[model samples]
Target: MLDQTILSILKEQDQQLFDLVLREETRQHEQIRLIPSENYASPAVKAALATSFTNKYGEGYPGRRYYQGQVNTDALELMVIERAKALFGYPHANVQALSGAPANLGVYTAFLKPFEGKIMAMRLDHGGHLTHGSPVSVTGQWFEILSYGCNENDVLDYEEIRRQALEFKPDVLVCGYTAYPRLIDFEKFGEIAREVGAISLADVSHIAGLIAGGAHPSPWPHMDVVTFTTHKTLRGPRAAIILAKDADMMDRIDKAVFPGLQGGPHFNTIAAIGVALGEAASPAFKDYSHQVVANAKKLGEELKVRGHHVVSGGTENHLLLLDVRKSHKLPGKRVAVALEEVGIVLNFNTVPNASDRQKPLFPDGIRLGTPSITTRGMKETDMVRLASLIDRTINNLKTGKISEGESAWKDDDEAVTIAAAVRELATSFPTFAW
Candidate 1:
């Protein structure tokens, strides 16, 4: 919880934003956040955000900043860059990019050219993200985008991926996702990219912590460039970074992040990222990462025990994608809303080859992760209870009592009762608020 003085200052300075803050705190306390892309930052990271560093305009990298007041900010930047390189085993790293999407865009700008080449990545419905070449995104509109997907058995088809790379002959090959639940074969992906004379770029934005904690394999030596958000499983502030394996790539990447894209960087966020990188290097962070995977696996098992279908049969990582159509004849969007009403938080996503009947499946599969819960000190037992809550919410949706427009789950007495029970369960595992 924030100090009373700060809360009072916020209320006096801006009542509207203060109200929103209170609402957010209430929401966090009442619900279990399972969104794979979301997590709570540590007190150190939060403090960095509210520091005077935010007031400084450090336009460029450390010593080369375009503005003054960067002496200490420069030190923080250099330290963060070094820590990131050490953590990920990269020869060089740029911690200035604002977020994952922007960091990826910087890579594209630095390594690729418009219309001169194509980029290959996994299909969006197959658990890849927008930056992975969704047609609507600038990455697709500017450069020719070729996509690969999981096989009929729901596993990444490396052979087919190689075939696509050969056919497309793209300049870059991307291996990453926003909702994928299986372990990635970075070495194999590297081999495929090399076979077709393409540079491999792995975006570990969703699983960086897992990689750092040794829960997932590192893609550094295999991929020429790697990019990721500092949040997610890393449990840091909202920022981004690009790591290059060679000095030649480093210069291009730095240029791309500066004149090619964003202006003055947010040194405060970078400072927070530095703190997080240090934290990730700790033994406790390693244990937390392992626990995240353990919790996700436990949650998936519990859901499957209750007759729910988990994509890939089970998860080996921090996140899981649920096929809502199995338990109830409902879409991902509906189940997500119902779950929200009942104090459970998650997202609806698309399964590979989800039918047009489930069109616009951005709201298709419910994507949830265990990073925050694990951070909250909840383990496998809590995961089982959370799964039960999700099951009950889905069952409630089956009753056809939940309309799309209903504002609050509490409006329905039975739903409210279930939500109360869920709240009570969450209260038992109260998150660290300081």
Candidate 2:
């Protein structure tokens, strides 16, 4: 929660903006917030972001910075780097990246020659991220991309992946994903990369906190370089960190992030990340991580009981993909909008085997996760209730009780009923000061 005094000051400075912020705060407090990539930052992390360090322009690494008055900034940056390395058990870490995408780009910049390098990555429709060589991204336009996808059963086929890697002979073999609900075999990826003479990069952007808390397996021994956003499951400010297994790769990554990519680092965000890393190292966060996965599993089970088609049957991680088109007989886009009306906010996503007719914007599945709700202290019991709420809302949509409109379905009686229930649940597990 923001300080009331600060709110007062902001209200005086710009009343309209302050009112909007208040509205957004109310919305956050009211909604279920099932988005996997979202989480409520702790008060300590939020305080760190509001520090005077944001005013600094530390343009280089700690010891050899390019700007004056970098002594404090250097110390802060070094603290963040050390904390990240210690937390993730990496030999080296760069905490200067603006976000996950740039951190990944830094890896490409560090090792690959422009317009010549080849990358083999998971297909986007199969749970991979855009930076993993989606044609719209710079990584795709600049490099030759060979994409692999999950098998018909919606799980990674390691043998097929290895075969593709060998045939493609890519410069880099990327693993990790955005919406994958199964445990990744980082060792298999490493073996395949080794056999094909490729660098193995694990973009654990979505699972860094789970890895830190031992809820998920670490990509340490097998991954050459790992990149992740600090904000997602890590519950920090919007920043990123890149970790490398060895000194040589670390040197190249640092050079790529600094002189080759971004200018000055966001020191305030780095400080917040350091705080988050400290929190993640605590036993309580480990318990929280475990609970996050448990809640997801329960949610998936309950959804399955409601006859929803959960991708891969259930989830090993914090996220689950629901085949809305199959389960509810409604497009994902429609269900997502309907859920939003009922205060259960999530996103439309493409399923592993989505037909060509199902466009990106109107995908066949909905992606949900327990991160934010878990952060709010919701657990397995709450998940069962949530699943019921979702089932009822979709049923209402299907029965034409909640009519769709150009705007959100706010005026519908059933949506209002579900929204009330959602508000009650959310208020019971308040995010304030957490």
TM-scores of all predicted structures: 0.95, 0.96
Say which candidate scores most in TM-score: 2
Query: In model 2, how large is the Cα lDDT of residue 215?
Result: 95
lDDT by residue (tens digit), candidate 1, 395-431: 6665345567654333367787888889998777656
Q: What is the Å distance of residue 116 in model 2 from its true position?
A: 0.5
Residue lDDT tens for model 2, 138-159: 9999999999999999999999
Model 2 Cα shift for residue 220 (angstroms): 0.8
Off by over 4 Å in 2: 399-411, 432-434
